[model samples]
Target: MRNEIMRCFAVVFTVIMIVSGCSGREETKTAGGGGEEDTKPTYEFRLAETHAPDYPTTLADKHFAELVHERSDGRIKIDVFPSAALGEEAAAIEQVQLGAIDFVRTSAGPLAEFNKDYAVFSLPYLFDSDEHVWNFLLSEHGDQLLDSLESSKMLGLAYYSSGARSFYSSKPLAGLEDLQGQKIRIQQNAVNIDLMDALGASATPMAFGEVYSGLQTGVIDAAENNYPSYYSTGHYEVAPYFLLDGHQRIPEVLVISMTAWEKLSEEDQELIRTAAKDSIAFQREKWAEYEQLAEEEIRDAGVTVTEVADVSAWQKAVQPVLEKHGADYQDLLDAVEALRP
Candidate 1:
């Protein structure tokens, strides 16, 4: 009877030990699974623009944010700050270069300082129409220009529409003669300054954010931008005349810091590229809609909208600028001229 009881106790002890060992193994595997999950990195990206959230570029950025989130399976996220929320265009570009900011949507004018090839886009009458600008941006030449930023630690993702920048002033400007001796605000680009000077205006380089105050205080008698910007920034209230000279059709760039870009997985990179392509299409549509809406809004606000009889008059005035910069910008000029209708 003693031997029988000992055998039974031994069997029970072995079974309990086996069961506890199995449980321990399962617990170890569970802990390892948790650790692996924790190892997955969560990347957050920031995008900054100098326009309002309602603008086409901002809308496209919002779409970009959504696409990134969806494509990355929530592993990546993007936050957009518009209306110079981060800083002015030049400041934002510098931040991206230093990796202090992840992304920026800035006009080619500011970017030209970093990459001289971009200066071609700032030349007056480089693009004849919206179609011309759009086609060139989608071409191989455009890709080459955009990719050139790689050396600067900035990667161009896509180009956003800046529309055509013409003149808006408190006084009427029918042609080049009307602009003689007038002070006009322009982006701090040599080509733009030259273009304004050629057209007989005293070009003053100023920040877009300061234009309203500058106009109000009579620091600048005129300024130029696209129709949407004129309405969105309320510049029309102060400068109530719009001249459709279409001197410069500068496109805004969507760029990412190379530091941030390289951190993304291959799959994430594909996702970004695909999303940017789609967002570009979306932006173009929104831009068309807003252009009409802005025109109506500004007109209703008592701004005079005038279409010049001869854009050639304005173009001729800026011809000297092209002559000086044309050799260096020949490739871009040729590309623009080659764009099919």
Candidate 2:
């Protein structure tokens, strides 16, 4: 009887040990299964833009974030800081180059400081229309100009809608002569300054983020920007006049630091490329809708929308500004002109 009891005890002990070993193996498999191990590497991407959250570029960034998350299966996440939350456009571009930040959506103005060739896009009347700008970006010359950033530690992903920048002021501007003595806020770009000067306005180079306060405080009598920006920034509240001169159709670039780009996996890079292309199309559509809506909203707000009699008059006034930069950017200027109908 004692031997039988010992045998039964031994059997129970062996069964418990077997069960415990199996459970341990199951736990190990569950923990280390597939590519989701607790120790697996995760990549965090940060993007900065100096536009309001409701702007089309911000919407594009949001779409990019979603697509990256989906494509990477949550292995990668993008954090988008809008409205200069990370820093102003110039500062954000600098941070991206140093690898302190992953991405930035910057206008051609600040980007020109890094690559002078980018200044071509900032030139007055560079692109005739939105379609012209879009075609140029996809063209060989556009690709070359954008790729020039490789030397600056930045890689261009895509171009976002900048819309045609036109003048908005408290006073009416029927012709180039009307701009005489007007204090117009221009971007911190030499071409813009020269253009404004040529057009007979007192050109004040200021940051886009500062334009509203500058206008409100009477620091500036007029400014130039897209319809959406004028309305969204509440500049309409002060300026109250919109001029459809369509002087420059500058496109915003979506760029990533080379450091960040090189760190992405091959498959991940492909996913990003595809997503960027899709986001570009998405952004363009949103831009059109926003621009139309902005026009109506600003008009309803008691702002006078003026259609200049002859845009050629304004163009002729700024021709000297073009001639000054033509030698260096002649090739790009010629190519853009060739695209005109």
Candidate 3:
């Protein structure tokens, strides 16, 4: 009876050990239950965007994330936080500078606050047309400007079109002459402030998210942005007068933190750069579509749309602004001028 009892105990102990070993193996298996080894991504990153999720920039951000994931063969993942979920552009950029945020799609306007070289894009009437802007942005000088961001601990991965900025006001603004003494909301940039001053308007530096309330509460008499922004933000509801002056054609820059970038292998870096460039086509196409739709929708909504048929007069008004700030960006200005017809 004692031998039989010992034999039973031995069998139970062996079975228990075998079961534990199998469970250990199961726990070590891939998340997909494909194999015995784990297959999680090597790196996971976050990208910040100040635009709404349905906005063109946000869509392009997702596209960029998808391409990176694909090109990296799932070894990498990029999660995009849009609509200022992370923070506003300025705060987000600071976070990125500190290496706390992996990436951000910020306006060149706010970006200039970090790297003054970016301020060139905010100069009013710098580009004759959208084509002129793109030509310069795609040229050798544009690449140099992008590379110069390294001084600020960031990298300019690519440029996405923000369209051209124009003024919209709570009160009627028939022409440049009407802008005198009007309190206008502008981006927080010295160049933009100077541009507003040169145009004879009181420059109220305000955040993008605050413009709607600013307009409604009369904190600002006018604000300037593109057609898509005016319509999408519903700024047209309160600011019924939309003047298509196209003052600034600042590009939205896709920037990555050098901290996060350094951790990536050269191959992955190249992959991300390519992915960002590839995403621009989609973003620009959507921008064009959205722009036209925005104009039409705002017009249908009874917003007065004024076209600057001859921007020469408006251009002449901003000459001092260019002359004052132009010295800092002479090389870039020369390059930009060379691109014009």
Candidate 4:
């Protein structure tokens, strides 16, 4: 009787061990295979843009973010703040430098404040046409300038077209002479200020957000920007005249904070770089379409749209501005000239 009882105990103990072993194996398999949450993003980043959500650059910013997220297999995520949610270009640039902001899409004009190489874009009449601008931007010289941002604790990812910035005002800009003595709002750049001064206008360094009220309240008689900005900001309502002088084809730059960039692995860095480059084609296409749309709609809105068939006189007026700033960037200017058609 005692032997039978011991045998029964041994068999029960064996059954318990077998069941526990099978349960442990199943848990191990589940852990090894991972689940939905395991594939989620490990890092999150932010990109800043002063343009509205519907603007070309902002759209491209979102596209770039999406590309990074997808290519990283959801290991990385980027959130874009458009319409100056984070801050204006200057403040955004400062934040990126400090790594408070991970990325920014801002005009090359503001970037000149950090690296002088970017000031080349701020030179009035520097690019003869849109093609001329891209020709230089895709060249070795432009790549050098992009790479040069590393010293500023920023990385230049890509460039998007801001188109040519032209002056528009409540007064008629029928000719270059009309710009004389006008109070024009411009970005806070010495070169831009000098360009306005050379054109015989007073340059008021103001944030972009204030331009509409400035024009309406008579604080500023004029402001310069591309067509999309003119219409999108509703500045055309206040400043009814549009000039197509096509001066200063300042391309907007996509930049990343070095602090944020270094945190990425080599594969991720390449992924981001390629994603940025890929986003450019889409942005450029949208930019061209929007430019035409803005021009057409603004004219329909009863805005006096004037084309400067003779930009020579306007270009000639800015000669002094070129000479003053051009001396520092002779090589870049030469490169730009070489790329001209």
Candidate 5:
């Protein structure tokens, strides 16, 4: 599994570098009458996504691209590559830094590998609720966190609502004790692995593409994700019990390559930024609609919608994981604690 995942990542880097790094895409204007060079400029940008076209993240990217093109009067074209056409987000992130790709939409899990400060947001129950998460993202502190990526050669443009993630398994989760001994598939990362360990479940990390099959074959007893993803990926076909524990409110982000940003004219830069921030409202509304639709439809399919009776117990159990991980990044933890709903 590890070798296959690495191979997937390797192919992305090799192919994308040749296309983006070794060449530049341009849009040029023709001289009106005289044999003079065209002064007007043109640009073509690439936006990478790991979700299907109908997915919320991909829909938002398309909407954002449309707005950019319309707002820029067609001088800027943002070609949206859905379903990881360019590469997985993790691989595209490095390419984004080198200007091999212009934009990416991904979860916070892979992003933390690029910046430790992002680790705070990935921690379980870090926010009181969705509104609390939004408040922090829109606050002055949130802007600072967005700006934090400047050091990493990327710019955090806006946050898209991914909703809260919960566990869905072949069997129902009655409470915290139910998690003991279950083999759960989590994002391949230290924080997530440690999170499962703390809960007494064995963490199995694998590619997202292989998850549906894994669950069907009993390779993993349970897998966790947002409701839209759970439905969209068809994981519910195997894991019929979904516990609305709402453990992690992992928000997705739209990022631009800093190297590419630097090359754009100041006026164009402002337009891109404005369009990106503007897409938040559109994406959030679509997300809310999808969340409602998924819940209603999934339950109607005879799947059990289990409610987490005692969240306090789950939070208490996961506290040690947060404490240990937060020790290295104390300021951010303090910042999260300082955030009041």
Candidate 6:
């Protein structure tokens, strides 16, 4: 009877030890799950836009945000602030460089101040037409330009269409000579100032917000922008003369801070890049539609829309600007010009 009890106890002890050992192994394997990483970490970022919600660029920013969130499966979230809410382009760009702001939609004008090579886009008549501009943008050279922002502590994701800037004034701009002796409002930038001065106009650099009032009060005689911008800002109410000289077709860039970008996983980084490029098609389509509507509405609102028959004269007028800046960024300009297709 003693032997029989000892045998039963031994069997129970062995079975219990085996069961416990198997359970411990199972727990260890389950915890590691074949070395898969945790997937619950969430990331959030902010992007700034200086345009109104209805503006094509702003709309594109919204679209970009949507695509990123959706493709990231909600792992990444982007908050977009429009209308200079975060600050103007310069301020926002500074914030981005400091990692205080994650992203911004800004013109190449201000960006050129950071990289002289960027001024290649600011050159008047750099592109023959909208189609030519797109070809260059979609090419590998454009990708290299976008990547060049690494030196600025920012990453250029993509370019949004701001369209070609033209002369709009309260007075007639029937010819290049008409620009003579006019106090034209321009973005507070060196290249634009030089460009206006070359055209025989007195370049009065002013805040974009002050432009409407300036035009209303004759603080400035003329200004320049694309159709949608001229219409959206109510500048047409005062400066109703729209001349399609199609000067600088400077593109608006979508950029993110290198600091913010580096924090992202490599996979997520690629995801954002893909999202930015994907938004380009939608943005271009929206910009074209908005441009047409803005043109039609501005015309209907009694704005005189003039088709400039001789852009050659205007182009020739700005040759000095080209020569000066071209000498500064010869390689960049030459590369851009080579993308004439």
- Expressed as tens digits, the lDDT of each residue in 249-339 for candidate 3 is 9999999999988887687799999999999999999889888998889999999888989989888888898888899999888899899
Residue runs of model 3 more than 4 Å from their true location after superposition? 1-41
RMSD of each: 14.2, 12.8, 10.4, 13.4, 6.7, 14.9
| Candidate 4, number of clashes | 0
Which of the predicted structures, 1 or 4, would earn the higher lDDT when compared with the native?
Answer: 4
What TM-score would every model get versus the actual structure?
0.87, 0.86, 0.87, 0.88, 0.87, 0.87
Clashing residue pairs found in predicted model 3: none
lDDT of 6 at 7: 100
RMSD over all Cα atoms, model 1: 14.2
In candidate 5, stretches whose alpha carbon ends up further than 4 angstroms from where it belongs are 1-24, 30-38
lDDT of 4 at 276: 97
User: Tens-digit lDDT track for model 1 on 166-284?
Assistant: 89898886666778888999888778888877987899988889999999999999998999999999999999988888888889899989988888667778888778877898888
List, in order, the clash count of every candidate structure: 0, 0, 0, 0, 0, 0
Candidate 2, poorest ten consecutive residues by summed lDDT:
21-30
TM-score of 3: 0.87
Full-model lDDT, candidate 4: 0.88
lDDT of all predictions: 0.85, 0.83, 0.88, 0.88, 0.85, 0.85
- TM-score of candidate 2 against the unseen true structure: 0.86
Quote the positional error of residue 15 for candidate 1 in Å: 55
